[model samples]
Target: MAVTQVKVDATEARLAAIPAPDKGAAWIEAARDAARARLREMGLPGRRDEYWKFTRPDSLTAPEAPAAALFEMGEPQVFDGFDRVKLVFVDGVFDADSSDDPALAGVEIERLATAAQTDIHWARETYGILEARGQTPVPRPLAALNTACAGDGVLIRATARAEKPISLIYRHESKTSDAYLHHVIRVESGAELTLLENGPAAARFNKVMEVDIADGGRFNHVRAQGRDHERRAATHIFARLGAEAVFKSFTMTVNGQMTRNECVVEMAGDDAVAHVAGAAMGDGDFHDDDTVFVTHDAERCESRQVFKKVLRGGAVGVFQGKILVKAGAQKTDGYQISQSLLLDGDSQFLAKPELEIYADDVVCSHGSTTGAIDADTLYYLRSRGLPKAEATDLLVLSFLAEAVEEIEDDALRNEVTARLGAWLARRRG
Candidate 1:
């Protein structure tokens, strides 16, 4: 097939206008600068780019580069009011006074920039190396842009075992402007870490986070993407798992103007297991897209993924999940399923589940289904004297119960459920 080219002057111009580089590790700074240069040469993603086809980048054209600011935040509330080690960032700058994580035992929690300055070895090796090995050429623009101007977030290291969970909150307080945030999370060996990532887009925030899980480790990552009506944001996450390592990630996209989430999980060792699941509820003119890629490169690896999307009004939802097993990745077991419910005639959903396997001794299966709410079930509920809106809400909850049930944390589960219920009320009203 012949390759055609399209001009990407806008993307190039936007990248070219970023401010001068600051003092940091010469290598990481250089790597970021190089990526920007490459992006300029490659241009922005277009319809030809399969990964970004459904969610175009044309609408993201900005008149000027985003500025740095100290955004005003709303009344602060604990993420479920948990007594866990916590770190807070408002508009990408760390708030030392706002954070109150009781200095836990057997954990090394420090500011990312502080760690980058004092203990450069650990920070550079974890963030710099993993990103290089996992980055792709297609979505290079986003990563490059983040690298060039990555604000301070958190860098936590769990020494042996953590008695309590380690939580981080990225809050967007400024509603009148756009803010950029970049975060890095790493877990060492023989350690257990639970991360509750809360992205409440008050005004607007564009964020990129990179996480790495070491050998003999377990990481549970939960993300809540709930924002006001005027907010627009995107999150790009890349994670690598070592031998006998486990990663379980759950994401709930309940509200937003435009939200895009992409996760790449690479299983590079034996006996590694990765479970990815998410639920999305969109209303009005919302655009929600969740894309995930799981690659198995070693023997005896397993992965499972399930995503459920509920669409109402003129909302558009997209789900694309792909699993790839390499030639030598024998005994790889992969399973994927995506289901969607279109509540109204004007609403739409697109689900694409794909599998590419080169190993003959592997077991892989994928399935996708798109349908309306079961009329018989709805009638049965209405027959029981329940209002139409209540019946629909019950059915929507029932449809998404499979994914919601996996959340082990009680506080997070209840909070997510409440958010979903609130969305259903607005839709059925």
Candidate 2:
């Protein structure tokens, strides 16, 4: 398929200036070459592009990284009590001194740079492969750019049921850092893995993650985009599921100046299940976007997308989600919902939900809604001897409960909820 031609403006030049990582492995180099070629043909998304109409791409595609002040954190770490293996990244570079041992019992972990030095590795075939596959129906030039130029990331393979989750923690100290990270995860047949990510990586961050779940494999991901109001990020996730495999991911974001999270999933085997959900809260010049695409190509596959955003004080939230059931994908079940809660008249929410089905035996549904807190509910809460601000907070939490509930892990859900509560408290104060 031919890539749609767009004008080569400053953004295109900026992308061209970025150097691609030169891995020693032949296959890795080949993948980067292919990605660079595709990116050149596609170019950066312009304001004219329909997909970028809601949010301007200028800030994300600029030649120089935006200046962002480092946030002085006062609260304890979100996953402080959790038992997990932690990998740390400082200013987008893997910090071996601060990270735990990469080697886990049932999982093999290698830094992308280290793995690339070997002539042959398991990641040779999977790295950037899924991202390349996802470009067909929709062109994700930013993701392709990350695949081509990302400086650091990880390659993880789960060979058996992992006893503990793997956590990625990012820390930012540079005021003008531009960080690009790419991760590859492969879950062997019957294996299970849980992955966790937290932090604001840098001033301007571009990230891509590709996951492959083998037959009967299970993968779970939970992430919290840190509360850095000056940060800007564009992240993408590409996943493929095999027969009876299960994939679930949930994200919680707060207070970034701009953030775009894109997820693409393909069910390539019968009876696979995939779910993606996010809960975001933005206030005062903040912008958040969630774009998701799920494709069903096998019989009896199921997929769900649930996203909710809370906007206040001139903040903006956008959601674009789609579910596609291909021909011969019989008995496919798909559902999608995107909702937003606006606290004031100045805040705005924009949503586009779609479903395309070629199979006659498929069941698909999509819905989008944006509104203020229910007057009746708020009145009831206020009448119960609660202050107006407290009552409003209650209603806001109620509105976000559905999406937060989508997190399958109880501990992670609680942590997310606590963080939301804290944010609400701060806003009210």
Candidate 3:
């Protein structure tokens, strides 16, 4: 592929920030080199790029993280009720002193920094493999940058059903901190595990997670990104599923100056299931984007893409989703929906929904809608003696119900709802 001069310069500028020395084991060093080459070839994203035309990449691609005021964390933390092992990161750096020992929870877990030092490790198979594959059809330069220069992360191997979930908590302390993190998760055959994430990591954050699920394995992920009203983040999740495996993930984004969340999945085994969903609420100076791609490469596979957004106070929201069914993938079931509830005329929503199919016997559908709250419902609630602000908050929750329902666990689902409600309440006039 021919490269542009502007892209080349930007890629080099970002690459220069990372140290030039090789500091990891042979495998990790090789992986990072490969990712560097890919990044060089693709270059940093620009507004002219097809996938990034809606949101500006200037703040995210700048040499340093833009300054952002820290929000107070006085409220109750999300997922505090779950009996899970916690891994903490402050300003994108791992906080070993404040984190729990990673040896618990029916899983073998290790930090990427430590695991990469070993000459032989299972992480070599996945560290940057999936992210590299996801680049095609669409170039994700930020993800490649993460693969090449991730400072800290985790490697989790689930051998059996975990008795407790594993939670990753991120905290922002500096006014201008930039962070990059990459995580790899492998669920062995017939195993089950739950992964939970919350908090805003830094002024600017770039993260990537690669998941590989073996036959009959199940992986569930629930994340909350919020409370920090002024922040920037670009995150990616790349997943591969084996026969009879299940992969489900949902993210709720509460606050950010700008955020882009991308998920790419490939179902290579028959009867595999993959579902990715998210709910985001944006206020003043906020811009959020959710981009997803799912490919069905085997027979009898199922996939879903559900996303909801609530925008107010001149906020902007964007969604780009696509599902592709391979030629021989018979009995494929693909569903996609992206909806936005615009609270005022000042806010905006942009969506690009697509479906490409090579199979004749597949069930695939996609729909996108942008609208305001139901006036009739609001009137009914107000007539029942509910305050106008409270009624609107109730309606906003109802609008986001579909995406939240994608969370399979009842307790976790309710916790997300409560967090979202609190955000709406705080923003209500």
The candidate maximizing TM-score is 3
Best by lDDT: 3
Please give, for residues 29-103, the per-residue lDDT of candidate 3 as tens digits. 999999999999898998788889898999999877788888677757999888889999887777899888887
- Give residue 374's lDDT in candidate 3 (0 to 100): 95
lDDT of 3 at 318: 94
User: RMSD of each candidate?
Assistant: 3.2, 1.5, 1.2
Which segments of candidate 1 are over 4 A away from where they belong? Answer: 1-8, 16-21, 61-78, 201-204, 426-429
What TM-score would candidate 1 get against the native? 0.89
Candidate 2 structure, TM-score to reference: 0.97
What's the number of clashes in each of the models? Answer: 1, 0, 0
lDDT of 2 by residue, 1-429 (tens): 344544456546777667656656788888888988887777777787788888888888888877899977665877767989999988888899999988788899988878877889998878889999998788888998898888689899999999999999888977646888899999999999999998889998999999999999999999999588899999999999999999999999988999999999999999999999999998898999999999999999999999999999999999999999999999999999999999999999999898888999988999999989898888898889989899988888888899999888899899889888998898788
**Number of the candidate with higher lDDT, 1 or 2:** 2
Off by over 4 Å in 2: 1-6, 9-12, 19-23
Q: Give every collision pair in model 1.
A: 175-203
- Give all candidates' CA lDDT scores: 0.71, 0.89, 0.91
Ranking by TM-score: 3, 2, 1
Q: Is candidate 1 or 3 superior in TM-score?
A: 3
TM-score of each: 0.89, 0.97, 0.98
User: Which pairs of residues collide in model 2?
Assistant: none
Report the Cα lDDT for candidate 2: 0.89
